[model samples]
Target: MANSDNNNKTAWQMATQVIHAGSGHDDPHGALAAPLYQTSTFKFANTEQGSARFAGEEGGYIYSRLGNPTTHELETRVAVLEGYDAAAATATGMGAIAATTMAFVKAGDHIVVSDAIYGCSFALFSELFERFGVHADFVDLTDADALTTALKDNTRLVFLESPANPHLKLVDIEAVSQILAGRDIKLIVDNTFMTPLLQQPKQLGADLVIHSATKFLNGHGDVVAGIVCGSADDIALIKGTTLKDMGATISPHDAWLILRGLKTLDVRMQRHCENAEKVADFLHKHSLVRKVYYPGLAEHPNHSLIGTQMRHAGAVIAFELDGDEAQSRYFLNQLQMIPLAVSLGDAETLIQHPASMTHSPYTPEARQKAGISDTLVRIAVGLEAAQDIIADLSQALQSSQQRWQRSA
Candidate 1:
């Protein structure tokens, strides 16, 4: 279904779009739910029709790998939500990053990346892509001068994640976009942390926006999917090349799950924001907490960018303990409610140590440079009652302090 014509014309708000952006989907049974096209291939009426589809002269799908109605619906819904011309869904968040970057970069190309990023992303740029001859410069995007200095004549992309993973360091998107404005270099933003509900990077001059739909987009932590939104021509190129050849296509079932999850995205995001704000305030006031890194805090370094870059500080919070690594580990173990795990934006609150877990791919020196301390803990606040979450954290903190004090 997705009535492309109507979606293009109507300027639906976020709440409306999340539920019905891909409405007008044609269903033979006229089911209330979007039809899940779960097959691996599609049937063509005739040889001529198949030839036309293969030759790009016709519009129907020939193979699920190449295209699927359910996946396309997810793409359309996300594209409309992000205010982009088109979008492509990938098997994983890393797939979206790889496909989008590989579709554009060549052997001799260079990319500038934010100093602080997801562990796998860092490994992709520093370890994998480097072997293939593409190089990247990891710099603190917060410093405009550093970004300016890092740009090269062969720079093809400037990649960054605002409110970056594990640390909550924010970059000025509009400023970075302006820096790359007249250049051929494209600005790619990982909007996984702040979903379209909180921030839309494309609206602020980014050429392409990427999301780990597995996180906030699905909001259920059930599907591991990714999305990249950009101009139609760019999406077509990505679809025709990297996605098609690299084989990182998403499953129809996963796409369908995401579509279902999108229905409650508005409410989920609102609750996430509200819960995170309260949790952050509690942590900031707690004596056992060292440094709290959440944009919601007025004292945060990037607090000024809150209204301009993002609607709110978002659901993830990164903070360090007053003690060292042992205390951090003990505190995480002492938590009874919040699960110690990786991945964010889930309905259940999750916490993890970045240095040894998510950002383990980075060397100690690299982590230090990126501002990921050994004791830093990241918490993805969930829909749990604020008071309950606070009480759990409070007990864990108190217990951690007492145990560490006794050992000392």
Candidate 2:
């Protein structure tokens, strides 16, 4: 049976628990925060005790790579927040994805995934996993029929990312979960875009939820971490095999940083949503913007579904400009406040061109099919004042329009 102390907590309760949960009171030295266990190996109490630990008869740390007190606290906090029985922390987001996928599939198994996942993740599946003899099918996640059609007899996993990176496309978690119910296939969702405060996939019937904690979960963008949350049995299965073999364990210092970020996640998420809404509204009204993709907007194709599934529209927003690569470059160069960078989910605003940046590895046709157009620009709205963000975007758009007129 699962431990009783961590059960029956609601999402709000879990958020509060994140502030004070997991080994805060265990230190005999009366330290308030969990200290980092930086040692490579732990000192065994005795030969019998060490044997017991190795044999799984006792629960204690054997090595920092396998486990650590600080990392365990971060895992426990993430599991509680995500409404899962347990969680495992990894060195990076890709580590979590690779570890989980490796744990669940074998040579003859097949996988189905959303076409609009993070570019790195897409490459990992298409290039690396395919080379390993594991077949993968990618389909537009918004089309339920396509997902169903992609599933095969040997399909062992279905991966999705709601409000997918760069495009901000929405996928109905509950709808997908219902479709895969009672099947051998496990539903794995990349919940990095929408942290636990905004959306909990497990509660909606997903078998597993993964996060690139470097994003919203860490909030500060200082540490790179990943988490996989699910039932105890599934967690133990991955922890015992894939995680142990892959050796992608998160460092104690990084875990501590992530824990610090989690303390104010609720407040940070609210501001991110608010600022993103304002930015989306500004972009929608701009003359240079051909299309704006944001769930908060009523015109979005999945707005209604997003309303039902997500607590908020989220911080990331994407829009297409009227011109080609030249114009897009001019616009990005004109921007003063927003930094031109690849990664998102930071305290300061960031902007990137997906066609030439994050999604550049994919073929042009593949990128277009995934809604990553040559003119597409993605904005990760930060904690900055909404008015200032809008003003900065206005100047950039105006500059792009003037440049386009000159070129024409």
Residue-wise lDDT of candidate 1 within 1-408, one digit each (tens)? 012444223323777899998766799888989888889988888899999999999999988889999999999999988899999999999999999998888898899999999999999999888998999999988898999999999999999999899899999999999899899999999999988877889878999999999998998889999999999999999999999999999999999999999999888888888999899999998999988999889889989887667778899999999888988999999999999989988899999999999999999999999999999999999999989999999999999988987898
TM-scores for every predicted model: 0.96, 0.95
Locate the minimum summed-lDDT window of 10 residues in model 1: 1-10
Predicted structure with the largest lDDT when compared to the true one: 1
Off by over 4 Å in 1: 1-12
State the C-alpha lDDT per candidate: 0.91, 0.86
lDDT, model 1, position 331: 95
